[model samples]
Target chain A: MAGENALNFQMIEAAAGRLAGHVRETPLLNSPFIDAIAGRRVWVKAECLQHTGSFKFRGGWSAVSALEGAGGVLAYSSGNHAQGVAAAARAHGREAVIVMPEDAPAVKIANTRAYGAEVVLYDRATGDREAIGAELAEARGLTLIRPYDEPLVIAGQGTCGLEIARQAAEAGVTGGDVIVCCGGGGLTSGIALALERTAPGFRVRPAEPEGFDDVARSLASGMIQKNNALGGSICDAIVTPQPGELTFPIMQRLCGPGVAVSDEEALRAVAQAFLRLKIVVEPGGAVALASALFQGDAIEGEDVVVVVSGGNVDAGVFAEAIRTYGDAA
Target chain B: MAGENALNFQMIEAAAGRLAGHVRETPLLNSPFIDAIAGRRVWVKAECLQHTGSFKFRGGWSAVSALEGAGGVLAYSSGNHAQGVAAAARAHGREAVIVMPEDAPAVKIANTRAYGAEVVLYDRATGDREAIGAELAEARGLTLIRPYDEPLVIAGQGTCGLEIARQAAEAGVTGGDVIVCCGGGGLTSGIALALERTAPGFRVRPAEPEGFDDVARSLASGMIQKNNALGGSICDAIVTPQPGELTFPIMQRLCGPGVAVSDEEALRAVAQAFLRLKIVVEPGGAVALASALFQGDAIEGEDVVVVVSGGNVDAGVFAEAIRTYGDAA
Candidate 1:
C-alpha cells in the first residue's frame, strides 16, 4: 500500500477528512509585490505556516496515522520532512526517530527534537541516509515512511491543492497557472492530481533551484533526470538528487515544463515576501515565488498561484537575505 | 454620527455584514514558541496581512461605505490608517484625500497613493494634520474619516474581535484572555463590545508602548491619560496622544488594567514573531505579543489571544530586527 503507483481523488478526499482539523488551513496571500513582478495578479498559498513549518506535515500525518500497528515511525530527510514526521508521531502518540544529515540547519534539528523525536545524524558526504533509515526501521519494528513516494504521503500532500482550488474559487478566480516548489516532485504530483479533479482548468508547473533542477530537466526530457551535485544551492531543504520514482509519472501526466531559479533569485523572493506579504519563507519554499518573480516573462497566467513550501530557515541566513535584498527600500 | 459616543454589538454585526466580501478574514495563528513563553496556549490574530496591511481597512471600508452621497472621503494618519482609507475609498469608487506626515515610511506613502488617494504631506513636529484634513474635507465637500474616534470606525475594528471569538471557538478554546494593541482605543473598545456579545467571560486587556501608554494609564486611573511624548518610540503606527473620548469609556467599562511594554520589548516580540510565527509584525502591532511574553505572570487564563495589529513596516527596520534579536539561532 505504501509503494502504490497511483493516488486518486478519493484517497485525497479521505486524507483531507483525516486531516480536517489537524493541519492549518494557511491563508491565500495576495501581495502587490508579487503582482508587480508578474505584471499581473499573484496569489500565494502560504504553506510556510503549516504545522512543523512545512507542507510535509500533511503527508507525515497521513502516513503515520495509517500505519498498521503501534510500531511507530522512522523517516529520513534533510529537515522539513524530518520535522513533519516527528511532529505527527508526537501527535499520534507514536515514537519517532529521524535520520537526518549532520549538517541540517540547527533550527530544524532543534524543532524535530522538540517534538520528542530521537535524532540519528548521518554524514551527508559519506553516509546513505535511506539505508540508515531502513536499517533503523527494521531493527526497531518501525514503519519506514518515505518522504514523498508513498501513496498515503502523496494523498496527504494533495490536500493542499484542494485548499488552493477552494481559496481561488472564493477569490473569484476560475483558472490560472499554479507553481509548486519541487524537490522529489511529491508536492507537484499531488497538487496536479487535486487540481485536475477540482479546478480542472488550472495548470501546474514545477519550480526548482538552478543546480538542483532535476524535476524541470526531467519534465522537459520526458524521463528521469538527476541533479549534477548536492549542496551547491542555498535552498538546502530541497537538495534532493532526483525526482521520486512514483511522483515523476504523475508529474509527466499532469504538469507542464518547469522553471529553474538561482539561489539569488530565491533569496530576493524571500525578502519580497517579508517586505510585502509579511511572511517568512525559507529558501526552498521561495523557489516557486522566485520563478513567478524572476521568470515572469515565461510564466503565462492572469493570476499566478505560488506555493511557498516552508518556513524552517536558519535565522542567520534569513537575516542575510533581508540584508541583501532589502537594500532596495 | 461621525463623533458618536458609543458603538454597540448590533452596529459591529452590521459592519461585519458590510465587510464580509471586502476584507480578508485574517487567520488566528497558534504558535508553540509563544505558548512556551507564557507556559500556556497562545493564539495570535494576525491582522497585519489585512488589506492595506492593517486592521484599519475594516474601519475605512465601513466608514466610506456608509458615507453620504458624492462627496468622497478625507483622512489623517501616519500610514496604516491612510492606506486603509485610501483603499476603502478606491474600492467604493470614491475619491480619497490623505493628510500624512512627510516622514512616514516610504512604503506607506507609496501604498496610499497606489490606491489612488491624493497625498498631502505635513510635518509631524510643526503641523496639525487634523486641521489639514478638516480644511481639505470642507474645501472638497468630502466627509472626514477619523482614524479611530468614529462610531463606524470602532464598529469596523470590532469585526476583528468578532473574528477572534469565532476562530477561538473553532479551535475549542471556550474562554480566554485577549490582549489587543491599543492606540486611541478604537480596536480595544470595539473588541470589548464583540467579546461581550459573542464570547462572554473572555476578559480583554490593552497592551501599549511604555512612554505612549495612554490607554493603559487611562484604564488604571479610571480617567483619561495623555502621553508625555508623542514620538519617542519606534512604533509609528500607534502613537495616539490619548484615548478617544468615545472609545475610552467602552475600554474602561469592559477591559482590565492594561500592561505596557518598552520599545525594546516590542522589538524583541517582533523578532520572535518572525523567527517563530513566520509572520512580519510591525513594532506597534507586536505590543500585545510583547505583553504576553514579558508580563507572563500578570497575564491570566490558560489560553491567551494577542492581536498583531499591522505589518506596514519599512523593509530596513524589519531587517534590523532580525539582526538584533535573531542572534540565538
Candidate 2:
C-alpha cells in the first residue's frame, strides 16, 4: 500500500508547477440567497467549471505529465475520470484507453470518445473492471493511471486546495470547514493534505450520497470500510465501493467528520447552483454543496467552503432537478 | 446626448481599478466539441458566471462606486441591470429602486429585491417605465443610473473587454473576431472601445436575435435604426428598442459588421454551453456564442472569442431549451 509519506506539500507544489497554464483556476462564488439558506457565509469553489467539467482533470494531467516515457495510459471510471484522463492524454499526445460500464450516461460515453480515447464498455454487474483494465494495460504496455491512490494524482488534486486557500483569503474568509464530494476519498484527502500545509485553520470534510457513504463510515469507524452495493443512487460519479487505501490515512489524519446527504438533497443543490450561481453541477458534484446548505447542524462556525466537483450529468436528470426543486431553492 | 469623448481607455482603466475586487474576472473556456462545431478554435468568455449572473454587475459597480454622494440610485431594466444595480448599491451601503415590467421573469425581480432594492413594477403595455423611474428619482433625490446611455456605465462595461483582451492573449489568441450580444449597444460598444485600445488586431461584432436586429441594421446603414416590436423572442434580456445614442457612435466607429441569429440558434447555444462548458447561459446571453458557432461563413478567422453575457434564465425556458436541443448539440 502507498504510505502517507509519499505525498507532501513539495510534491503538490511541483504538481502545481507542472499543471500551470494547463489547468483552470476556477473561482470561488457565493450568493446572498445561498448564505441565507446556510445561515452562514458560504463560499463555493466551482471545480465543476474545470476542464473536462470536473476536478479530475487536475489529477489526470498531473499523473499523465509526470510520466517520462512515450507509452500510453489506461484508466477505469464510471465517467468523470475517464474523460479527464482522455483529455489529459490527448493534450500530452499520448493515446488513452478507458474501461467504463455499459450503463454509463450516454453523454459521458460520447464525451470520452470525443476526446479521442478508445473506450471499452463492460457490464457492471458481471464484469470485473479492474481485471479488464489490468489485462488491457499489460497487453498494450500502457501505464494504469489510478484515479485516486497515486501520489502524483493526489498532488494534482491538491492544487485545487491551494486555489481554495488563496481564493478564500481573497474573499475574506479566514477559516472554515471545506467540504468535498467523496468517491474514493481522492479529492477529499488531496484537499485535506493541501489545507494541512496552507490553510491550517480550515478543515476538510467528505460528503457522500446516503447509500454510498463508505468514506463517511470509514472515517467514523477509524478503519477501512466498504459499501454494500456500488450501483445505486443518481450520483454515479461518486458511488465508489470504498475509500482508497492510499487516501484513507491522509483523510483520517487531517479531515473532519464526514457528512452524508440523500440523492434528493444532492439534486436540490444542483438546482440551487443553477438558479443562484449560474453554473451546472451534477448530483455527485453537488453532495458537498448539499451538506453545506442542508446539513448545517453537522458543521460548525459561521463560514463554510464547498467544492462543486463535476458536471457530467445527463440532460434528463438535470431537467428533473430543476423542475422539482427550482422554485423551492 | 452622451458623447463618444466621454468614454475612453483611461476611464475604462479607472473603472477596472474600482471593479478590481468587487467583480469576478470570469475565465475563457473552450471544448474540443465546441471547436469542432465552430470549424475553428473557439474561446468562450464566460461572463454569465459573473456576479449577479451577468456582466452588467461590472458596469453597475462602476457607476454606483463612481457616485460622489450617499444618495441612492434609480434604474429601469427588464432584469439583468436591475439585479446588478441593486447588488452594487447594497455593496456600497446605498439604497436602490428598480422599475421593472410586471411581465419580467420572476427570478430577476426576486433577485433584485433580495439584494435589498425596493422593486417598483410597471405594465409593459401601458405604463412608461422611464417616466416612472424619472419621477421616482426626482421625488427621492436618487441618481438615475442609465442601463447603457451613460459614460460611467459604458466605461464600467468596458472592463469586461479589458479582461477579454488579456485572457484571449493568455489563451494564445493573437487576433480574432470578438462577438458580443448587443442591446442598446452597451456591452458591444464598451468591448469595442476596450479592444481598440488594448488589442488593436481584435475586432468586435454585435449579435442580436432575428427580429431585434436594430444594431445590425444600424451598423450596415451607418445610421440609427429601431426594432418595430420589443417583446418577441425568448432572449428578453438583450431586446431593446434601439441602440443608445452614446453607444451607437462607438460601435459604428469600432465594430465590424453585425450578426443576427434566430432564437432557435440561441437556444441551441444555450444547450451546448450547458453540455460542453458546464455553465448556464440564457438565450440572450448565448446569441454571441450562437453566431460564433452557426454563422461561420460570415466570420473570418482561425479563432473566435464570444462572450456569454448573462445567465438569469427562467427554469421553464431553460428546461425547454435543454429538451429541444440537448440531443442535437
lDDT accuracy of residue B216 in candidate 2: 95
Model 2 alpha-carbon drift over 4 Å, by segment: none
Per-candidate TM equals 0.97, 0.98
- Candidate 2: residue B175 lDDT (0-100): 93
True contacts kept of each: 0.54, 0.68
Indicate the docking level reached by candidate 1: medium
- Name the docking class for model 2: medium
- Per-residue lDDT, model 1, residue A113, is 88
Scoring model 2 with DockQ, what do you get? Answer: 0.72
Model 1, residue A265: distance off in Å is 1.8
Residue pairs of candidate 1 with colliding backbone atoms: none
Give each model's whole-structure lDDT: 0.87, 0.91
The true-versus-predicted C-alpha distance at residue B169 of model 1, in Å, is 0.5
